[model samples]
Target: MSCPHVTAIAAYVKSFHPDWSPAAIKSSIMTTAMPMNNSNQVLKDFAYGAGHVDPLKAINPGLILDLSEDDYVNLLCDIGYETPTVRKISGDNSTCPSLSARSLLKDINYPSIIYQIQLMQPFVANFTRTVTNVGFANSTYKASVMKGSNININVVPQVLSFRSLGEKQSISVNIARGKFSEPTVISSPLIWTDGEHSMRIPIIIDVTQT
Candidate 1:
């Protein structure tokens, strides 16, 4: 059942652009999904990962956070993988860097952000994302944040301009703790809109004692 569904979407995308990776196809499907059910009720937590697939919107998601094999290798290295093990998995001559040099798991080029923050510490988490424009050229998108909790969220380069199709731009999200007294998970969405299209990314911040 799911295989045919995925294949249809993949085929539609491939018909237009044959260069998209499996990861990109998956991201597009997830990020553009509808978060509501037939009754117009919002989906539950982690339901379908990013809710039910929206195949039409997935086709033209405006912007995509593409990933490569190196990104997966970095994800493994971030979780304390040794050089030899990482290199073995990658089947390459790559070397894992020191802990300080390793990329943070939250920094992965994913469609959504998931992070944990210490409840009592003065903490700030930064996530840098690159988006490839798939929408109209000469478009400008503005950033907006929707909150379900008390974290302070800011997006640098608040406005993005695309000169041509497939143009890539970098955006950074800076999240700082503020009045997060209760130990709970706070979820929000960082949205970028260009009047016609919107790129929405869900952000879940886990507040706990570290």
Candidate 2:
């Protein structure tokens, strides 16, 4: 059986990027990891969660979904923690932000998209992401998706243009869930390519039959 305790990749990445946060480190490992099987085919999520970790590619992940401390705090509170409970967990007396200020889990800055399917009902989720340019300047990246199941996936601003290094761009992933006859899961890739480097993010959708 494959071990679920996989921290070597994250630890290795942290050694080089000590300043990166936990989320960034995880994103690097997952976004750059291999999703292919020994036969060179894309493996399902049940087989591999973002596939095998690649140390080299992870070090220079073209883009990262950066999150701040406040983002996490808000995430916890949004999930139904009162102000005092949040303060206790954060080891600080910070008060919870107003409901209007809280961001949903789907809005968290994650490199990949994950959604819980609503049985017998179609749903839509929009995920916002920002990527900093670590590659060459004056480059444009085009977005593409490997179709999976019957979901309708679209990325706004299909093309990203960067004039200088370290420039950040925003991307919105709009996923419209499709009805499934049975409980199942589907996987796909949301890729951004500059005709040279490809930043691939594995997208997983879990469906349940009601």
Quick one: best TM-score, which candidate? 2
Report the C-alpha lDDT of model 1 over 42-86, residue by residue, as the tens digit: 333344456667678888888888987878878888887887998
How accurate locally is residue 46 in candidate 2, as Cα lDDT from 0 to 100?
57
lDDT of 2 at 79: 87
lDDT of 2: 0.79
Candidates' TM-scores? 0.82, 0.85
Q: List ranges where model 1 is wrong by over 4 Å.
A: 1-11, 37-44, 98-101, 120-122
Off by more than 4 A, model 2: 1-6, 38-43
> What Cα-based lDDT does every candidate model obtain?
0.78, 0.79
Q: All predictions: root-mean-square deviation over Cα?
A: 3.2, 3.1
On a 0 to 100 scale, what is the lDDT of residue 53 in model 2?
73
Question: Candidate 2, TM-score vs. the true structure?
Answer: 0.85
Q: Write the per-residue lDDT of candidate 2 for residues 1-210, one digit (tens) a residue.
A: 334445776777889889888887777777777776634423367566777778888877776667887988988888898888988888888777888877878878877787878678778888888887766888889999986457889999899999997798888998986566667677778988787667887778888665
